[model samples]
Target: MIYIVIPVFNRKEYTKECLESLRAQTNQGFSVVIVDDGSTDGTEAMLRDEFPEVVVLKGDGGLFWTAGVNMGIRYALEQGAELIMTMNNDVVVDSDMIAQMYRWHREKPQALLGALELDASNKKPIFGGERLNWKLNTIEHLLHVLPDAERKGLHPVTHLPGRGLLIPRVVFDRIGLLDQKRFPHYIADYDYTHTARRAGFELFVNYDAKILTYPEESGERQIRSSKTFKNYYKHLFDIKGGGNLRDFTRFTLKNCPPPYVPYHLANGYARRLFGYFLK
Candidate 1:
């Protein structure tokens, strides 16, 4: 069985739209698991009223993205789900996207899969595969340069985002759930996928399977207009800030070779410092 696990904290309308899109999918073989992490916006009540068929898991609001998703994943495994898809609630997927992803999964049985995310306004890609650029200590996104035709084929990626990502049960059994304690919010998905890749899993983005993304409604995003020296230090370690320096440092130290960690950290700091002044 395939179970789609969604972690939501408020934004009832977005979640409602996401579930509606899933319900309209061409593939009727998948079930949904919603981990509502203390949504005060009547999201849980709405689910009970409208989409009760979806297995709903409640949280006390403390469980952030990583743990919230982990909770639903554990439930899916317990219910004999062979495949688990982790996705955010801010996307509207194409009707055939799920079926397309399943078909690709059948073809690449050992690979971790992600979907091409496009902006809702212009239908242009919002984000794609993220590859760590060690020299600049920043992530390079493929959508910025990928040709439209090339996107119609399979593209290998170093790090796949969590949105519309398909993960087989064996991966969880092998590497365990995402590191919630270390990454409560932002950096968890990249860290989890990196761990999976280290465990011999090939990560990829099947650009043919696409979804419309509401980027403005998504998770913590850094504001370039407010990138000042003091403001940078203020939210440097704050989990709500997208540019959490501590999390970046932790990710670097955990993934980079011991000898390169220092250099990467220094480079990352310099770039952020420059952004403050340049912008």
Candidate 2:
């Protein structure tokens, strides 16, 4: 059976809505675990009273999504889950998502997991996975863009996103659970994909599976100061380089562009570069 794990922090209303969608899934042989990462907004009480059917794992009051995911992963493993599905608490899934993903995995027998294409507020194809721009050392994917029909293979993907990802138990066996200390938040998805590729497992994006995502505002000016932007790339650099700023520098500009890059990121890159040269 599959184990669906959601990591929530202070998004009570959205989390409740996400769970309700899961409850309506056509494939029902799965257990739901919600990891409440030290929310203070009455999330715990609400879940207990309103959605008692979901298994709630209380965090140590400050564990973020990475930590929360680890908690749920461990629990799912203990419960003998063959496949583990990780998703954001703010998003909902298609009823056939898990079933289709499971069927795909069974057929491929080699793919580690499947990612569902997401529809953001624009109703356009958002993130799934993409070919890494290795020359720039950054993970790049299209937003609001559809895949080319001439693309090489079936269900092709070079990376996976955080919105909707399914991981088989074998992937964990190969790479171990996600590193919580190294990646407290964003880019953990990319780190995991890179590691999985190194371990020789293929990842796929199932276009047939789609979910709705509350789109975040994007622009070059916003990147520098935006919490989401910082959390994503900063952790990515830390994990890939072991705290080396130069490696982080290569990644920041290599995969990201100015219109989409934040202003603060430019400054951060400058400071990091100076620090590197001075050292």
Best by TM-score: 1
1-279 per-residue lDDT for model 2 (tens digits): 778889887869888888887887787878889898789899999999988888999888777667789899999999888788888887877777667776776766667565555555566555655776543434455432554663212366677765667788888878888767656665566667767876898887776566776655222223333445454354235433223354444434443454544653555566554443232
Model 1 worst lDDT run, 10 consecutive residues: 218-227
Question: What are the TM-scores, per candidate, against the unseen true structure?
Answer: 0.92, 0.75
Off by over 4 Å in 1: 133-139, 222-234, 276-279
CA deviation > 4 Å runs, candidate 2: 136-154, 217-279
lDDT of each: 0.84, 0.68
Clashing pairs in 2: 136-254, 223-262, 224-262, 224-264, 224-265
Output the lDDT of residue 241, model 2. 25
